[model samples]
Target: MPSVIESEVLIRVVEPRDLREVYEVESMSFTGSLTYDFSVFLFYYVTAHDLFLVAEALGRVIGYIIGLIEVRRREILGHVISIAIHPLYRGLGIGSKLLKALEERLTSRGALRIFLEVDVLNKPAISFYRKHGYVISGILKNYYGVSDAYIMVKEVGASLKQF
Candidate 1:
């Protein structure tokens, strides 16, 4: 088997101009109506603009991740809103890098825990989160209309480490 080359993936804060390509990557990474529309992305940007991030290689946007923070009572909760990588960029560790970036940002802002919802059928994503120390907290019925979703949670300071 040939060795895998880990390309240089530059992670950075998302800019207004990057939305088009980010949406394209999001569309490619998901199927059916699960893909987020531009308006939803815009809403996330407007609400948590500082938490939006994108990964680039050779001047092309290859992956992206967005997060939201909420302070409930006294604890800061971090929510992984969305994450996607271009089909060609999968298995290159770009997603991992992007996730780490978001986690670091959340931690810097004093997030106590981080969580996300993933489609139950997406085994690869479930495995990825599990490797990152996320546990299944519960299930969201009909999270995607006809499909259910798994609620995954990870304690920020415990599991998310610098890479």
Candidate 2:
């Protein structure tokens, strides 16, 4: 089953029409965490569409990643604002593919580093980020208004590792 899911995965740019499904996946992915509302997704889509991506399987949206790139302190930084793979799609390499796609897009736009915050208690997510070469940078207290989060960063450019 895992092999079959992996084989049919397709990565593509996020379109306005995909927003609903994207939000649905996000809601599912971060059930207890702070998932953004539709309005927030719209704001990001309008401003940072290039950094948004979605993964599809059998023509259904199965996962997505929303990112933002900004030039801060003269260094272009990419922030993984949100990423979610439907629970059913877990362990099929979709998350890694989505991350790689977003990183590649950011790198092409001269981003020097990529960062994201993960719930401190989500060990699987923490491990996943580490596996992709992201290191813990700091902690944000009350990141979800109830729990803390760890900021993880991965250097892009020449040091970026391909999955």
Candidate 3:
């Protein structure tokens, strides 16, 4: 989590100039989102411009989440590929804020719902989404080339059913 330093923080779309910093975060974050032998994160960095996002604190990039819309079943939905916060900055609500920001971006693009495939072993992320109103729709076997994927979804607005 980021410190309560009252820094200027903003969430914005990924721009060309941000590629370097974004890649640095990607390289330091995780492998699935890395795509190209964990190098520069080029698989999506160079391919999906609109799906990338960066959270800048002060003048440095602090957090980021990558997502894109893809066909599931017969409809299109937003899928968050990755969301990471600097190790020292964990527990600051950065990941939640980034997810919400991505949801807004996906919604503006006609996405009726948002979804993600997270590692079943990633207890924190799964707990975070489940607590944030995301339900585990299903589970995919070896969805990420090596591990299973927990398919989670969150419907836009409100639903009649409440836990």
Candidate 2's C-alpha runs over 4 A off are 1-3
lDDT of 2 by residue, 67-143 (tens): 88878889889999888899988877889999999998989888989999999999999988999999999999998
Question: How much is 25 displaced in model 2, in angstroms?
Answer: 1.1
* Candidate 2 positional error at 38, Å: 1.5
Residue pairs with backbone atoms closer than 3 Å in model 1 (clashes): none
Model 3 alpha-carbon drift over 4 Å, by segment: 1-7, 31-40, 72-74, 158-163
Q: On residues 1-163, what C-alpha lDDT tens digit does candidate 1 reach at each position?
A: 2233455678998888889999999999899889999998788778888899999887778889999998888889999988998888888888888898899999888897998999999999999888777899999999998999999998878556634
Query: Which whole-number lDDT from 0 to 100 does residue 55 have in model 3?
Result: 85
In each prediction, how many residue pairs overlap at the backbone (N, C-alpha, C within less than 3 A)? 0, 0, 3
Assess candidate 3 and give its TM-score to the true structure: 0.80
Q: Rank the candidates by lDDT, best first.
A: 1, 2, 3
Clash count in backbone of candidate 1: 0
Candidate 3 lDDT tens digits, 1-163: 4354423568887776766776676567676643434344566777657678888886777778888888778887888878877666667777777777787777777778888888888898899888778899999998877789899998874441232
- Candidates in order have lDDT scores of 0.87, 0.87, 0.74
